[model samples]
Target chain A: MNKPKHKKLTCLGIESTAHTFGSSLVSLDEENQGTIISDSRSVYQPPPGSGIHPREAYQHHSDVCSGVLIESLRKAKMDMDSVDVIAYAGGPGLGPCLRVGAVVARSLAAYYHKPIIAANHAIGHIELACMLTRATNPIVLLVSGGHTAILAFSNGRWRFFGETLDITIGQLLDQFGRAAGYASPSGAIIERCASKSEEYLLLPYTLKGNDPSFSGMLTSAKRLLSSGKNMDDICFSIQETAFSNLCEVTERALAFTEHDEVLLTGGVAANTRLQEMLTEMCRSRGSTFRVIPRQFSGDCGAQIAWVGLLSYLHGMRLDISKSIVRQSWRLDQVDILWRH
Target chain B: METLIRKGAEADIYKVRWNGLLAIKKIRLPKGYRQPSLDAELRKRRTIHEATLISAAKLAGVNSPLLYYLDKSNYSIYMEHFDGPRIKDVLDDPDLGTTKIFEAVGRSIGSLHREDIIHGDLTTSNFILISDGCLGIIDFGLSFRSNRLEDKAVDLHLVKQTLESAHSAVADEMFTDLIDGYRSISGDESTNRIKSVMRQVQRRGRYARSV
Candidate 1:
């Protein structure tokens, strides 16, 4: 216990996916993995309903670039040169947003003569979630604006246990928020609105085995709102229908995975209402429910850095040539070389 | 006479006495994984919705159980106790005929779809044989109001898929009889409207399985 098995690997992680552009520097536990030395992030929130203007997001990243990176180094209180590698969210994000992180990491790797690691943004969310929660072999419910999927880690990578057939849950919620006169990234507000009303409006409860569809539910919620349904009631009904669908599909996945832990990650994990539903589902199955704390739940650089370090430790590719941002990378496409 | 009858993910059912009358009680079990407030609301709402759906299915000409009482506080319902074997138990019975039961299964589902009511979980187990050899639809936990052909097709698809996976030998004959009953009850127009949608669903199912 006195000595660790492998030497610590220090890395700098940059995340510029969607509306968040930030950086973090961490020294990972080389043996057991995922020991965070330091973490930091900065998010760019636009007006409600106008989410992530790709060009504007890129400009925002460039505008606040130096401060975020400097803060991350300051947070770590480590010499910049001591970092062994530069890792960035490489794909599964807006091209312009992803390019910012890729270019930054590429230049840093070039300047430092170190390797560059390109990791999937979605997988970054799951990896950081698993690390922070310390959930081994857990079903990952990665729900964010750009993605919503039920992923199970197996063999060496995450596979789709089930995912959205139409729009992501985040989009589902945001659309309802917009229709109800809220701004973009309005999950928190929607949750509060839902809490205020207890009325249950009939909405489409679409579930095809483990997969689910929210397009119908979202449409119905909007129609009900316009027809003079109470705003709070519509909000409440939307969450009830949409979240219950999530719980049902997740329960099916749990039945298949038969794992003891369910890890909730991504931006929407902030909703306590959602946490409650998932918590109850897990408890019913005698399983554990773990979520990334509020601070780390959203898009964060620390998660990217830590995930890159894990993959790098396991001999994953580190070439800047092929680190292009993949706008729609599926989780199953990535070979999760780190986990056995 | 309280005797345990059935239990499922959302609720528990018991053959119990209601006002000294033999009735079935459906109590929505508290899910510990849910937040207390959300759980209570869901239990209350679903109990009421299920009870409402049961009656609507009956009005739509399906022989659903008669609802006797609604106890909102405990999130329970008292309904007429159906006597006879569950359709699942007699799905492939050698001595007992199964075609008529399958036809009734189709008609019950058709009746619900005809009224824009989707029986969320439409499986053989949710159907029971009554004393007169008629099929009674039970359990509306997942039922909802959606007139979309897609939703209706999905409902029919669930029944077909459940039978195919659970009762392979009789799956073909049962499905044929079920469709005949659905077409006769729902009429060719509405049934035809769902055929394309049903095909799309089957294709999606195949795609999901292949990958």
Candidate 2:
């Protein structure tokens, strides 16, 4: 749909798909360019040596939802009346976590009499990165705790060319880190440890066609750690093998689509080593590579707010009763109404 | 004389002269991104594996490029080149009677499955429509011997995904014809089993819960 002349809209988005409860405000001006007004989030830290418990994560989101929302609006120096739409991450995540965000958004919409939008978490990541990086069409390598897929837009939807057949890259790092007595979500620490060693251990590099399976590699890494292998060397080898598998699949997608740009998004996009490797690969093949800024690379409310604004502008208005969380929603199943 | 033709993710294809014949040479290039030892091992293994699968595919009565030579040390393979359009480029052409072509594809895949061969990559791009109007399969780099029903289902699922994603305009008609052709060779019982398994495979994707 063509934008009405000089039309402007503001959206407030909530994200509680996992451990983080985030809120942000985005404003779209007459030019259809979106500006993030404010972004605030509170992340729940699980007990040491344990993964996130879904119930505890839900409680964390419920406790922090209002505070994060208020902080978002306060930082923007705007109130709820200024927001033209309310949006929340609706699916493809933990059901309990998603419910908290959806409930909050629904409650706000009811109180304020504002229209609501149910945004797909994965699409939020992609659209926000695309807007920030100015990539119109590109092969997307979405890597995170819950996802690892090489995708491209075709036939009005994101189509997966390849993905992890088992555990994701993020899970691989987190589980390995936990095996070494670190808490979950230990990608940063793993990266730090990996950088200190140059040794490479040969682990199973499983690539069934374009799809990569990391479960076997994770088991092997744990075995190495138990057998008294140096943690740093194992970390180094895991990163080397896993990142290479990712890049190889991405390269294959690039060859098939011949897209001039490649966009890296999601939580694991924060890894500098991955960014470097992807950049080098793209350079060798004459394609532009862009990573979402480090701060915005991970789960954030800004992505939800930005995509929410797009959905609003495209005339998507979900009734509060009909607006519910879909825990099993897939990215490719979402329609791209805002994009051609 | 040799001239480069296509640079694939795992290998580079070249149009070359082999013993006064027009042939193709596929060389698995060393990836700079992977560790040197890992890269060397992967390239060598895939080069040999592709050669083996290609010969096996022909023995199973599948139409594939004829092998001329295998250069193990160089991670290269020399084979007869059949110049034609990729099936991806022409599957939807209304004038081509595309249903029969898709049926042929299914028949070929059914035969491969019967021989316990799983073509890990089954995209339309890997199929070539040769001069004699016969369907030719290429790229056996990911092919493997598998008797598992899951493996066979995955092969079928990949073809469905490719058609839906890259050739949506005529996917419905094409897929129906493909299943019919496949059933003619595989019989109704195994086809039904494979179809059910393929449904499970589709649902097993991340965030794709079974309903």
Candidate 3:
């Protein structure tokens, strides 16, 4: 979608959500035409049972920040000065990790005299996924290490219909996997094991009204494992319960929002079972199901860069002196406080 | 004329009138140990970062004070002046006896955490009971987006610690209410994360005590 007579705006985006430290340079022209010129990512996977420390993640950011920036720019075939804006994940992240990204972004903004845009990491992922598949007004099921919510895009904002009550789907997967002596952040491994296990063990499934109780299920699974149950069966059972709960929530949210399309985003969106279940749910309802490619599904900077460009197009320029790193910033909080 | 409202380790807050509207100014102090140039750069960056975060949270439908201005060169943030009692103040006063207040605070915190933004220091003091009775989170200078269980757990731990330290008499009750409220917004996964992290926090606490 290349066009002439439109001023091309280039953006450099940085993402530091969880274990991934990512940077991407995207170029958007007039009429919102965009292209991802370069993207680089670094992941820090700690050993099993050893959780990700905020300070350690921050250090990881510090170690990879320069390289990621340099590589993204090189891939984009542009220099730092050519970047029209700098965007970074603002909050719903680790404090130290967010600080590192913010510091780098601010420094770059200062050095280049470019406006800085801060985006909510989750919203960034959602928008990018939606844009990738051209999906609109879909039922969104976001499941990651930190979040599990059924959302719908309406009234110019995402309306949340249902979500987990205790632990995030990804977190539950990781914790259960770790307890079962798997690697750290055991989403992929658990998915693999669950695929192999044939028997389904009965676990606690507490559906409280519209909300699903994951903590109860996790506790039940842990107890079952501790009481000499099959680890493989428990893993498979937990995945099934979590995915089933998510699917039920998504169906309810879809019915409540009265939307047909379902778009899934987040790290755990990569699970084949979740994808299969969601696809089936959508198919049964004659609705559409969309999942962005795995790279974009997880944390990345392209969406941040794109959203930053949208803000710029809307004339929301940052007062260079007024930019700061926020560890807990949210997307809805933007309109209340920020004025152009 | 401006009045000094409050002071913390990192900032001195001032109540000022802007165009006949009330505003709060958070000014960062220069660090002594850091080189002058580095400190100035650091202060300017931090001031902007905090202001940006406040604006971001406001956009996400989270209750936070509006950011009026950021004087990054001077390391100061002027935000919509909120006139309300801090949640901590409300919780500490036995006469208030607002049992439902804890639930409200918990929901607000839970909503924030659900959005993946953890208030690094989730003390009751960080929230203001607005005139509308809605709890507004303040001081996003230490906020961040994280999907890690440990990070989220630490945020809850901070809140738990705050309750134990400042609201001990009703700490257990308040914590339960908060979790209940948090569950209402965050759903079951958040509760599970909290339970897991809380267990870890307790274990760590025990280890610390033994050491």
Candidate 4:
């Protein structure tokens, strides 16, 4: 299949999927190659042990949106009139945060007389990873603070083969870390501490026939941490079990899809051990494994902007009047038959 | 020419182009929750207050965006724009692996607070990693001029909280570098205030949890 000739389109993307409120600008050329001129992100750190509040997150977004958006455009050396489309993560996030993004997206589209492209934040992440690494027909393992899913893309659509049955991988890490007297979003700290220790304790590994249960494992890890076990040991066990479960599900997805490529995305993918394990598993299976660099792994607006350019080139546009933020919009809900 | 970008709970930011250079226009957005006439009066006063603070920081040899324009009628102020990554992203990178960056962050923040500027939001996002490797603090929206030790301590406390919550793996090393830099710039007395503030914040956090 010949690659489609890409035209130059400038897209502004807004991302507020979890705790980060980010904006970026992407300019795609005729070869479908792109340059991310500017990207700025503002993260809202909730008080320790507090779940992310929607209203507060929204207020944070509103607080920083102007500076972030302007910085992105200034870096791109473009004006609002020069922007071709406005893209935003539309769902599966805090409702108030999503509303802030949606309101800005709709407002920008209306003001610029441009099209709005409401993107599936998760899919946008995977697509950006694919574009960056040039991976094809891969089993995508998306593990972030809020989501954990195994997706297979083929025949022009992505299919969800398996996912977390309860809490996401990052959430598990955070919960266990907090229980251990650490702060929230503790994946990196746990990984760092685990790297220091050598002994591995047995943590619960819940692989209940293709579906993974992280809450149970989290509880088990919490119990071990509270039981006066070594903190490093608990961290190691949890990391090992989580990575193993992910590898198991990923391997199953590859077998089911018969795909030779596996790509890892999301914040947890930044963990060196997880990447190495996934890579080793794929190598053992005689399959290819790819991961985007750490900078591109998390929820960043650059990914959204890049995908937004692609959608614009493909003539996928949203009606500004009807476009609204959806907190639970699924990736598969949109029909791509027209493109084919 | 200044262009509107967005309005927040406390301020507004704009994209301004001046003499072939891009800049940011910030204004204190009005808060209606306060007494109506008082809100308007406060908004007007804050625009001047923030602009004066930015200028003062610039005069103090700090690497802040340059102030170019101000219009109190609309609560608007313009300053030079920076085109660079945020310090948060720089620290987030596993490859960069440099402690100096954090030191620079700490020193810049220290200088600001020492000069009586309390950055209400001290998250890594509020600063930028300019091309020259220097750090520039942006978004004075939540910032105010204060000489109180509690405010300076709160600033340090917020930075610590941010590191622990967002960048936990390197939180200890990064925050240490920050303190070292802050101490060198802000003097021993200021550092003591920061330490005391840190204790107070932690105790408060613990007390709130227990309650």
lDDT of candidate 4 over A1-340, digit per residue (tens): 2346655788899998778888998787777677777888888877776657777888899999888888888877888988888899877677888887788788888877888887778777788888788886578888888678787653355645555656789889888877776766788999998898867665565543344778888888888777788888778778877887788678756654457899999889899999888887776667899998898888889877877777767778678876777766555454433232
TM-score of chain B of each: 0.91, 0.94, 0.89, 0.80
Q: Pick the candidate with the highest TM-score.
A: 2
TM-score per prediction, in order, is: 0.68, 0.97, 0.60, 0.60
Query: True interface contacts reproduced by each model, as a fraction?
Result: 0.10, 0.46, 0.00, 0.00
Count backbone overlaps in model 1. Answer: 7
Q: What is the interface RMSD of each candidate, in Å?
A: 7.1, 1.4, 23.5, 23.4
- Model 2 CA deviation exceeding 4 Å by range: A1-6, B92-97
What residue pairs are clashing in model 4? Answer: A6-A30, A92-A327
**Global local distance difference test of model 4:** 0.74
Task: Give each prediction's root-mean-square deviation over alpha carbons.
Answer: 8.0, 1.5, 21.2, 25.2
Q: Kindly list the per-residue Cα lDDT of model 4 for residues B161-194, writing each as its tens digit.
A: 5565446567798888888888889888869777
Evaluate candidate 3 and give its CAPRI docking class based on DockQ: incorrect
Clashing pairs in 2: none
Tell me how far the alpha carbon of residue B12 in candidate 2 is from the true structure, in angstroms, after superposition.
1.3
Q: How many clashes in each structure?
A: 7, 0, 48, 2
Give the candidates in order of DockQ, highest first.
2, 1, 3, 4
User: Taking the tens digit of each residue's C-alpha lDDT, what string does model 2 give over A1-340?
Assistant: 2565656889999999998999999988999887888999999988767888999999999898889999999999999889999989998789999999998999899999999999999999999999888888889999999999888888888878887877899999988888898987999999999999999999999987767899999999999999999999999999999999999989988877667789999999999999988998888788899988888888889899988888888767787889989889999888888776
Q: Write the per-residue lDDT of candidate 3 for residues B1-211, one digit (tens) a residue.
A: 6898764534678999877788888998764322344446546655765777777777666888898877756788888877788887787677755557878877877777767776665767678888655778888766767767776777777677556534556779888888888888888876887778767754442112221
Model 3 has how many clashing residue pairs? 48
The superposed Cα distance between candidate 4 and the true structure at residue B65, in angstroms, equals 75
**Alpha-carbon lDDT, every model:** 0.78, 0.88, 0.72, 0.74
lDDT for each residue of candidate 1 in A1-340, tens digit (9 for 90 to 100): 1223568788888999788887987667646656666776667777766666789888889888778888878877876788988899877778898888888888888877888888777888888888778887788888888777787775455766666767888988888787666778888888888899977777777765446788888888888878998988888887877788788777766654446788999998888988988997887778899998888888888888887887777778666687777766666667777666
